[model samples]
Every structure is written in C-alpha cells, then in structure tokens.
Target: MLKRVERPVLKDIKDACVLMKDAAFPAPFDSRLEFSCSARGFWNIVHTGMLIPEIHQVYVCAQGCLRGVVLTAAEMNAIDRFSNIIIRENNILEGNNEDLIVEGMGEILSKLPYTPKAVLVYTSCIHHFIGCDLNLVYRRLREKYPDIEFTDCYMNPIMRKSGVTPDQLMRKQLYSLLDKQELDKKSVNIIGNNFATDDSSELVKIIRENGFTLREVPRTKTYKEYKDMGKAAINITYNPVAIEGGIYLENKLNQKHLYLPLSYGFDEIEKNLDILCENLGVQKIDFTENKKMATEAIINAKNIIGNTPIAIDYTLTIRPASLAKLLLQHGFNVVSLYVDSFIADEEDDVKWLKENYPDIKVYSTMHVKMRFVDRHSEQKILALGQKAAYFTGSNNFVNVVESGGMYGFDGIVKLCDLMIDAFLNEKDAKKLIQYKGLGCENYDTNCK
Candidate 1:
C-alpha cells in the first residue's frame, strides 16, 4: 500500500495580506506563487517587433513556447512577416547548434517572396543553454546575406530576473539598424512607443506649433523613412522602459536625446513640459487653458463619484502608484492597488500613499489566490484598468492600457472623462478584454 501525499496550500493574496504602510519601496511580495489571468494580454514582443517597417522576424524556439507569438502574429493579420524554427530534443542533445540557427534563418530568407530591409533572428534560451556560437551565427548570416541587414534578437526568459528585460533589449535592438546620417534640425524622433502620439495630444500639438517634424517608428511604412530616424535633431523617449534605448541612440549616433516621461502629478507634468521646451529651444507655450481644463475635469469627476472606492491596476500605466496618490490628493477614494513593483519615479508617491493611507490594501494580482478575489463590494466601486476591473469583479471600469494615446495636460482631462463615463455605464469585460492589445488594431475578435 502506498502512502497518500497531501497537497500543500499555495501562498497567495490572502496569505500575504499586504497593506500600503507595511509594504516596501520597490517590490512587494516579490517572490510568491503567481496566478496569471487568461485575459491578461498587452503589447508583447511580437507586437513590439512589428513596429519596425519592412523587417521580418524569425524566432527559433520550442513548439510549446512558439504558440503565443505565432497566434499573436496571426491575430495581427501579419503572419506573412513572421516565421519560426522549432527546436527539437535531438538538436539540443547533439552538437552543431550554431549551424541550426544560421542554416534555419537561411532557409526562411530563401522562402520569402520579397526582400526585407532587415531580418531579426530571435534565438531562444536553449541556444544560450547549449552555449551556441551566436557571434559565429550572426557573422555567417551577415556574410551570406551581404545585401540584407541581419540583426540579432533574443527570446530568453531567464534574463528577466536580472539585468535589462527582454522587452527593453528588443526596443534597443530595433534602433540598431539606424545608420549615422546628417542631422535634420527641424525634425525629431520619438522612440519606444507602439502606438502613435495622438494629433490632439498636447505633445504633438506643441511640437507642430514649434514647426518641427515629429517622427515615430510605428507611423512609418517605408524602410527609408524608418532609417531616416537616425537623422533626427533630437530623440525623445517618454517611456521609462525605453530609457536605455534612448541612451543607445545618443551614444551611437551622437543625436541629442530627451527623456520626457509622462506623469499623473500636476507639478511633474508642468516640469516635464518646461524641460522639453527649453531643450527644444522654443518659447514655452502658456498652459493656463490646459491647466484650467484639467482642473475642471477633475472636479467634475470627483463631484459625480463622491466616496466611491477606486481600485488601481498596473495595466493602465507603469505609474499606478503615482496615479493613486494623485486621485487620493483630489479626494477620490482609492482603496486598493495591484502591481508587482514601483519604479524610481514613484518613490515620493509610494511613500505618501503608505503613510497617509495606511488602511488602503496593496494586493498582488500575480498571487495565486487572486483568482478567488472577493468580487462583492458594498458600494459600487470603480476600477481604472482592465486587470483591476477583472479582479474587483466590477463592470464599471475605464478600459485603457499603455496610456491609450493620452499625454500631457490633455491626458489628465481625458482620464477624467474616462472615469466619468466608466462610472455612468457598464462594459462587458469578458468580451472587451478578449482582444489582446488595447489600442492595437489587431485581433479578428467579433466582440471588438
């Protein structure tokens, strides 16, 4: 007779039971059993890679791991631009790993109907484990395809725990194809954004007002135009994740770079705008009307939803902590926040929340028990992001991710509008979140 083994209880949201005051500065519940949501889909590596114009991606990885990227490409209706090579058990066991990547990529290029300006060869963790000669592989590819640009990309998840993330590296790699060009003083390039800056955005409006040509990678459709990014007078990176990419541009091309990250706080936004104008050497446009509009919008939303507990989720932006502090300052009841870590920019905001709002719960959405999150709230609670909406089990949520093309003081006003609309109506979260990318025009989902 065999003895029965009892299952151990997995530590989760209920077990950790975190609150704001008790939490640390950066990571809260850093190491814990995580539960991933089925609807948890944002702009992933596949989508990120597609931003470059006239570039084909060939990923060499296991079949199981390839499914997500394959589907992502298919969903985007861009299967033609994507290819993958399956890594077999024998290939790993046997030697000659270097030949696998070089030869495999060669075959993919031969099958293509048209020539691409560049090819991103994505090698997997298996290659790293076997110590595959990546240098030899890229050198061989470059030698063979002298006319075509051969760029190295990595799909290694092991590096996620240390150093720069795979996503950060991917963004950096995209700009590597840019060769040095004569500077175009009136033109500027903004890097590391999947979505184009909205025309209505104050950032875009201000740049145009200053008589400058603003170029973003996503908006480029031609290979020449994409390469022309190297010639820009200034390279601006607004997202924190893309800071390294910005630095790479400045170092390699000697192009002036500015990091104007978005913010929820009024003071930060004003300071960022001033810095941007000063760098551009343009007179600062008066933001009196913009500030007035944002102020009015904030007041209107607060008046409508008085004392309604709001739950903040990381899906909205990287600055969820800052957003929570901003809302709390404005008298909006923010009771819960769901995130893994806080960035350096939010140090003050995190401290403010922890000290001032000690009772506010800080829950880990990744915790295994988050799947069993309490859906019932005594009052009608408002959720800010999709994950927050799903976890809180609230139908009323502002369905936007990755900033939703919102920037500058206009973004503040637009956010308030979203809050007001979310409070007034209900959305089918199950149906809406079914689409992978929020602003991404991909996905053939009928519900979308």
Candidate 2:
C-alpha cells in the first residue's frame, strides 16, 4: 500500500527563504507577506527569481522533457556568451538515453578542476515520465563536490501554460541570485538580458552618463557580486519578462522599480531618460537633436511612401505596435498587424491603439488565416521576424526584415530610407512581385 502524506504549504515558503538566504542574498523587500489577492500567482512570481548568477561556471543538463525546442534555443542563446559551460544531457534525436546522457554529462562535469558556480538540471518529457528525482541527483552530486551551486529547471515541455518556459526559468535563476545578495546603494541591476533584440549594453552606457552604476545580472562574477544587487536604490526593467524579476526584487529587497517600455524610437529613449532623471534626482538632459533627426527621417520616408499601406508581423506585439504608431505618425497606413499571441501581457496596448488609431487592424496568431492575407491592401510593408517573413509574400509587399536594430534615431532613419526606396522604385516593386510569385514566371513583367 502506498503511503499518503499531507504537504505543508508554508513550510515550502519558509524553507525556500531560508535556503535562499544562506545560498543567496536576502531580498531587500519583505517576501514574507503576499502582495496580490491571488496567492498562487504571487508565489509563482516569487518563485520566478530563484537562481543567482555569480556562481562562476554553470552546467545545463536536460532530462529530455521539454516541449518546445524554441525554449531551449532561447536559453542557450541567452547563456552561451556568459563565460559559462552549458552541457546538454538528453539528445533530442536520441530518445530514452537519460542514464547514458546523465552519466556522460557527470563524467565531463566531474573532470573540471574547480567546482561549478551552479548546475542547472533541466528536464524534458522523457525524464518527467521516468520520474527522475533531480533534487536527489543534485544532493548526491553536492556530496561528491561540496562547493558547486546546484538547482533544477523543472520545466515540463507539455505544459503550454503562460508564465512557464525557458525564459521564465532563466528569469527565476536570476532572481535566486538577487535573493542571496546584499544591496548596493549606487548600483542597479539590468534585467531581461536575453538573446532577443534587447541592446542592454548601449542603454547601460546611456545610464552611466546619468551618474548611476549599472550591473547586468547575466554578467555577474561572484555570489558576493550577486548580493550587491540588494543595495541598489531602484531597478529598471527593460522588458515584460524582466518585470517579474523586478517585482521579486521590490518585494524582497524593498527596492523601487520602474518598468520602462522597450527603447525603440526617439520618444521612447527620451521617456527613459526622463524617468531616470526623475527617479535618480538628476537633471534631465535634452535629447532634442536626436529627436529632431528621428522626426526628420520619418517625415522624409513618409513623403516618399505617400500613404502606402503597410503590414507588420512580429514575434512580440510591442515592436509591431510601436512601428505601427511610428508609421501612422509619418503618413503610412498600417492596415494589418500580425503578432504572436504570447506577447500581449496587458490590454493597455490594445486600448492605446483603440484610442489613437481605431482604423488599424490587429491579428493574433490564433485568429490569423489565409483569407486575411488574400484580402491585403496595396503597397504592403511586411515588418516581421524570420519565420513570419518566410510565410508572407505579396506583389505590393516589401519585406523589411533587414532594417537592422530598429531602435533609436539612427534606426528610424535607416528603416525610413528603405521604405522610401521600396515605394519609389518600379524595379524594387517588380522584385517584390517576383519574390512573392505574383509576377510572370520568367520575371519579364515591368510591374509598372
């Protein structure tokens, strides 16, 4: 007969806090109390920031249970450059190879002269089904090598729910480090340093000029360095995913946090600067020159395009929405917006669109179909990711995927020039037509 034991709810919380306090830094904020009415949501959010970055070297072990290859790809891309060694145990092509895989990984990791900062053991479906006790393995490994940091990435690939994925998992790891540290008054941590289009280094340079020290969580050197995050007066989260970590920091370290929209256009950059000045109690410097250059570039592009209908499909809704807003301001009609459903974290974006431009159409991946594309208007500007670019093709459409870092004033000018050129040239239009299979088979059509 199987024995059933009642689980202690508060015990997990207390134990997590104690363990984290010893292994990491105590969050400056009071984590004992709950913030939201929803206990489950609050705990999940708290659990999100459960790993530290200062632990030197890290070992990534997969138990072969992840559902999305994209999740692993994102994690690998994010951590690959962090001066750490990532070792994958379970092979995607080779199934039921957990023991052999784990053994091989163990051998390789054990061969290292010094202990790793952390060992992040990630599980896919195969290991989850086999009911592998990663905690036990972690404990056993710790016994053999007492100095290494150890943790589990208990991500179920089949779990298609929001707030779960490699992205969230990685964020949790960052949070754990924050919990283990002491606060730094002059220092601030940069969250959301992922493999996405986020250019944090450039932003850090701008912030440093404003007289603040910035520490990127992904670039931490030691556990002591991780603890120093608690001393920061505030945290500036660049992305929505980063917000969760900021919230954790605010709750634990009692640090003030402000969520700045991802810096794309000149306006966004100015707003970011304004917020920094206001919070840091520094004088706001004028970015008027940058703003003027951006505005002029946008205006020039608009004059060339002359009311061309543009369509944008992007991985995240914010980028497309911002692009749509910019294009609309410069006289282009954003007829269609294609976005991934996962990106919509708040309805404020939808509300903003409704208030400013009700005529523009927005389509999520869930509702998009072939009919939508067939009914597109003329002179389309397809701003999309690699995947979205591959699927979309039209005679009136110009794929503007290579605009290169569509952020800041310089990016605006480059994108505007491309759009202007695409709209004015008959040869460019013909090329687009041929690319989309809308022109003659031999590419003989003038398209004018």
Question: How does each model score on lDDT?
Answer: 0.82, 0.48
Model 1 C-alpha RMSD vs. true structure (Å) is: 3.8
Model 2: lowest-lDDT 10 consecutive positions: 37-46
Task: Report the lDDT tens digits of candidate 2 across residue range 1-448.
Answer: 9989752322122222121112211121222322211001011211122224323322333423222332322332322312222224334344434344356546756565555566555444555666555656666666766666555554453554444565555574555544535655667666553321324333454567766777654345465665677678778775666677678778877878887655445566678767867777777777777678778888877676666566665542246666666677567766766543324432444445557776654443332232233322344544333223323343433344322223455556556666666555433332332221121112221110
Q: Tally clashing residue pairs in candidate 1.
A: 0
Candidate that scores best on lDDT: 1
Highest TM-score model number: 1
lDDT of 2: 0.48
